[model samples]
Target chain A: MRRFAALVRRDLRLSLRAGTDATTAVMFFVVTVALFPLAIGPESTVLARIAAGVIWVAALLASLLSLERLFANDYEDGGLDLLALSPLPLEAAALAKVAAHWLVTGVPLILAAPVLALLLDMPAGGFAVLMASLALGTPSLSLIGAAGAALTLGARRGGVLLSLLVLPLFVPVLIFGAGAIDAALHGVAARPHLLLLGGFLAAALPLAPIAAAAAIRQALS
Target chain B: MALPDRMAYLTVAMHRFANPARFQRIATAILPWSAGLTVLLLAAGLYLGLVASPADYQQGDTVRIMYIHVPSAWMALFIYANMALASAVGFVWRHPLADLFCRAVAPVGAGFTAVCLITGSLWGEPMWGTWWVWDARLTSVLILFFLYLGYIALVNAFDDPVRGLKAGAILVLVGVVNLPIIKFSVDWWNTLHQPASVSRLGRPALDPAMLTPLMVMAAAFMAYFVTLALLRTRAELLNRRIQVLQMARGAS
Candidate 1:
């Protein structure tokens, strides 16, 4: 447990010191959201109708942008080899990296979503549901994205390949996360959508780490 | 062997054919039969599907698209299942031919999926009043197509062929979880796509006249896949042999 925490802290500090990953992701999120108004015009109803979908998509893309560096840096510098040789289980190590990634990228994207939602003229009723869905959903994105990152390590055109591997898997999260807001806006119960998001997170949390660990082992081999 | 031991024997028998030489011999012997069956069934199916069957009272000739669409859709799912099962065997048992099966089946599966989507769209244009709908079945099948593409890309991505195969095997296992979700998405969502007609618990809702042609076409497609996969796997093995020979020559 201590070793896992230490790994998470080490990743956090490394990302923080380098500083561009989180900021770039957040900035990308903001810029992508900002483009919607310009491209679609400032028509309130049109923007309102698409607000949930736009936010969810932009968040997904922003998280994807930061995913390439998740295992690349460590794998390149031989840090991954030492980690694999460590006494701690590689699954736990994978989980720690995913958690740290969620903290830096997912959290900021969640925090930034509501502000972007406002620009889309999203209903007042949707704010809480939007945040809640993203809060529940983004961790799964980071977890699943970690698996993609591990799978593509040292592969040619890895960044593009990672998106190809990861984006289709992101559909369920997009459906439920955006569905929650859509439900809330229509004065319907958002609970089912939120519950589904939770269900996905619960399933992904345990399974993704195991898959990522296997991929990492293959990469190292 | 006793009943419990029978399964073990079968597994052992299956593994015995994992040797490239043994597999090549068996594949070569079966290829002609498989190719003949594919041609004969396809000819019979197309004649029955296009000419022998009466047009649908409601859908008219557009119903003919279902002959191609349904079978291709079935093959798409079937091939993915085969790939996943083969990948699991490769990973756990280290069977050499299991990964080869995965590599050979992927593009064939993708082609089937594409046929399903394109024919579906053509049928929808006349029947559903649109080229496409966000129907849960169509959407999930589209996702399945993407999964095949991802598998193919991952299998060729690495400089080391063995590493690529291992990585692709893991991915196939991961993507298998999506299969159940895709199969059930229509039932859960109640979208624009028709509910299950053929695979339900009771007898299939399809009429025998319509059903026979569909079954024939499905058999033809299955044979087609088997014939192509065997040929592809044999080619892959030959490629590996040539590469080894070239490397040995360079060293000498």
Candidate 2:
């Protein structure tokens, strides 16, 4: 247990020291959302109509910006073999890496989403649901992206291939996350959509790590 | 023989042909039969589907596209399920044939999915009055196509063949589990495709005249899939042999 915490702390410390993942993700999130209004039209009504989709998609893409770094450095430097051979189970280590990734990139994107939502003229009533859905949705993105990152650990053109592998899998999270906010904006209950997002997170939590660990093991072997 | 003994006997019989050489002989024997069946069934299926089947009162001739569209869609899903099963087998038993089968079948599955999509679009422009819609089933099938592409790309991405196959097996398994969640979430978000499961319990609520062509086309598609899969696996096996020979010559 201590080792698990230490591993997560090590990853967090690495990211903080690099000072890139969180900043780049948040900056990417804001910039991408900003572009939507410019491209679609600056009309507040049009912006408001697409606010949820724009925010969710931008956050999803922003999360992707830093995903390749999740295990690439570790795998390249032989640290992944140590992790595999350590007392901690590979699956637990996989979870730790993904958790650290979520804390670093996913949370920042979530935090930036509300401000971008406002910039895009999202209605006031949708803010709470938007935050809640992001809270539930972004972790699923991290979990899913971790597997993609691990699968592409040593591949040529790994980043582009990672997105190709990961985005179709991201469709559900995008749907439910955007749907929940859309429900709230339309004065409907967001509960069902939020619950489904939670369900996706639950399914992804255990399964994605196993897949990531398997891919890591495959890479090392 | 006792049931357990009979099962054991069957296992030995199958594993005896697990050797690439023995598998080749069997594949060669089955190839001609499958190819013949594919040609005969396809010819019969096309005649029935394109010429004999009644035009829908509403759809006219465009109803005929479903004959190609639905069967390819069925094969696309079927081959995915088959690959998932093969991956699990390869993972658990470390069977070379299972990995080879996955590599062999992915392109075939992707081809079926492509046909399903294009044929679907052709049908939709006439029926749904758009070339496409973000409907639940349409989106799910499109995702399935992407999954096939991802698997094939990952399987070929590595310098080491074994590593690539192992990575792809993990992906295939992951995808099979996620397939339902994706299907359900999209259904919840919006449903434009017909709920198809409701029709599976009995004969699919089609006129017997129309159902025959659909069934024959489905059979033809299955035979075509079997023939192609066998041929591809044989090619993969032969390619591996050539690689082994080349490496041996270089080392010598």
Q: Pick the candidate with the highest lDDT.
A: 1
lDDT of 1 by residue, A100-150 (tens): 999999999999998999889998889999999999999999999999999
DockQ of 1: 0.83
Count of backbone collisions in candidate 1 = 0
TM-score of 1: 0.97
Candidate 2's TM-score reads 0.95
Across A1-221, the per-residue lDDT of candidate 2 in tens digits comes to 89999999999999999998889899888888888877988899989998999899988999888999899999878899999999999999999999999999988877777788889889989999999999999999999999999998888789888998999889889988999999999999999999999999999999999999989988988
Q: Score each candidate by Cα lDDT.
A: 0.93, 0.89
lDDT of 1 by residue, B58-137 (tens): 99999999999999998999999999999988987788689978998899999999999999999999998999998778
lDDT of 1 at B52: 98
